[model samples]
Target: MNASTTQAYEPESHADQNSKNIIESIIHGLDTFRKFSRLYAFMGHVAGSFFSSLLAVDNLSQLNPTFFNGYLQYIVPHFFMHLYVVGLNQLADLEIDKINKPYLPLASGEFSLTNGIIIVASFLFLSFGAAWMIGSIPSFWGLLASFVLMTAYSVNLPFLRWKKSTILTVMSHVIGMTMSFNIAAFMHMKTFVLKNATSYPRSLFLVTVVMPIFYAVVATAKDLPDIEGDKAAGIKTLAVRLGSKKVFWFCVSLLQIAYGAAILIGASSPILWSKLFTVSAHALMALILWNRANSTDLSSNISLQSFYMFIFKVRVAIK
Candidate 1:
C-alpha cells in the first residue's frame, strides 16, 4: 500500500512540475515582450501627441468605454509600428548591438534571428493593414514615411544606409518623428474624430513646430551612449565625429535653449495661468536637466547608458 501511494504521488508531482514550467515560460515570454516592444517608450512617443490633440479639441467630455476602446484601436497598430521600427534596427545592428547592447534579445542569443524576423515582418504587415482598414490618410502616409526612413536608416544596402551620414540620420529622425508623432496624430484627431473644418489650435501648432527641434536633440543624444559600437560599426553619428563628451554638452545646450524659448513663449501667453504654468514648468525642467548633466560621469559606460534613458524620460515629460 505504501508503494502504491508513492507511485500515485509521483504522477501528481510530475503533473505539477509540468504546470509550473508552462507558467514560467509564459512569464518569460512576457518579459521578452516588454524588452522587445519597449512599450513604455511607445507611450512616450505617441500618447502625448495623440491625446494632446484630443484635449485641444475638447474631447475629454466624451470619455466612455467606447472612447477608450477607440483609443486602444488607434494605439495598438502604432505600438506594433514602434516595435517594427526598433526591432528592425536591432536586427540590422546585431553585431553593433553585441558590443553596445549585448543584453538585447537578438544580440544576447535569447531570441533567435528567424523568430525575430518573423515577428517583425508580421508587425509591419499588421501596422500597414490596420492603417488601411482605419482609412486615416495622415496616419497611413506618416506610417509609410516612417517605414521608409527607418528602413533606410538601419538596413545596409547600396546607397541606402542613411545612418552613415550625420545629416541624413538626423533628418530621418526629425522628419519621421514629426510626421508620425505630431502631424499624423493631430490630423487623425481632426479629420476622423472631429469630422469638420480643419484647423490647428495654438497649442497643437506650437507642439508641431517645436517637436522637430526636440526630436533632433533626442536623435543626437541617443547616439551618445553607443559611441563605441557606432565607431566600430563605421557609423558617423555626431557623438562619433565630435566625441561623446562634446556631443553630450552640445545636446544639453540645445535642449536648454529650447526650454528658454518655451519659457519666453509662455510669458507671451495672454492668460496669466498659462504664463505662470508654462514658465514655471520649463524652468524647473531646465534646472533638472542641468543638475542631472552635472552629476553624470561621462567616462563610465553605465553612466552614459543611464543618462540616455534619462533623456527619454525628459522627452516624455516634456511631451
Candidate 2:
C-alpha cells in the first residue's frame, strides 16, 4: 500500500484500539465495584431499605413509574454509602481480611491499597453528592450518620475504631445500618413519594423494634468466624471476648427473641392477611434458625462461615 493509504489505515486501527481500551476500562471499573461489595450484605441492605419504604406507601395506585423513580432517587445514594461502609472496613482490616477473607479484592492482592482508597473515596463522593442533590433532610442525616458510625467502626484512628468494643460494635450496626437502610428509606418514601404527613406505620414500628436486635446479632455473630483475625488485630468483638460457642449461642438466642417479638407484633396487626402471614412467616423463620444453628459445627471454621453466611442471607430474605 502507498504511504497515504497506510496512514489512513493507521488512524482507523488506532481508533479501534482506543475504543477497545475504553470498553475494557469500563468493564474493569464495573467489576471492581462488584468485588468491593459483599453480595449478601448488599442485598440485605437493599431489601431492608426497599421493604421499609414500601411499608410507608399506602396507596396501591401510587406504585407507579414515578414512585419507583423516587425510590431510586434515595436507593442509589444508599447503595453508594454501603460501598463506603464495607470498603472502609476492608481498607482498615486489610491484614485481618487477608486472614479471614482472602478473596476480597484488597486482601487478595488483585487491588492495591491505593485502589481500595480510591474506590472508597469515589463511593463516598457518590453517596454524599447524591444525597445532597436529593435535598431531603432525613436522607442526608441518615447517610451522614451511617458514614460516621461505620467509619468509626472500621477506621483505626485514635479514640475511634469502635469495633474494638463489643457494645460499641453492636450499637454501631444496630443504629447505623438500620437508620441508613430502614428509617431513611421509610421517611423518604413517606414524605417524598406518598407526599403525606409523617406518621409511624405498623410495619415501620415492627422493623424498628426488630432490626436493632437483628443487627446486634449480626454484629456479634460476624465475629464468630473471624475470631482469629479479630484477636490478632486486637479487635474486641464478642466472639473474641466471649468464646465462639458462647457468642454463637448468644447470637442465635438473640435472633430467636427478635423473631418471637416479631411474631407477637404481627399478631397485633389489624390487617387480617398481614397478621396471619407475618406471624406464620416469623414462626417458620424462628424454627429454621434454631434448626440450622443445631446442625452447624462451630468448631469448624468452614462450617461457622457457612452458618454465618446463612444468617446474613436471612436478613435479605426478610419481608
Backbone N/Cα/C clashes per model: 0, 0
- Global Cα lDDT for candidate 1: 0.81
Which lDDT values do the candidates have, in the order given? 0.81, 0.86
Q: Give each model a TM-score.
A: 0.94, 0.89
Across residues 205-304, which tens digit of lDDT does each residue of candidate 1 receive?
A: 6576666778888788888889999989888888888998998899889888878877887888999999999899989999999999999999987898
Top candidate, metric lDDT:
2
Worst 10 residues of 2 by lDDT: 310-319
Backbone clashes in model 1, listed as residue pairs: none
Candidate 1 TM-score, true structure as reference: 0.94
lDDT of 2 by residue, 108-163 (tens): 88889998899889999999999898887788888998998999988888988998
Model 1 Cα shift for residue 128 (angstroms): 0.7
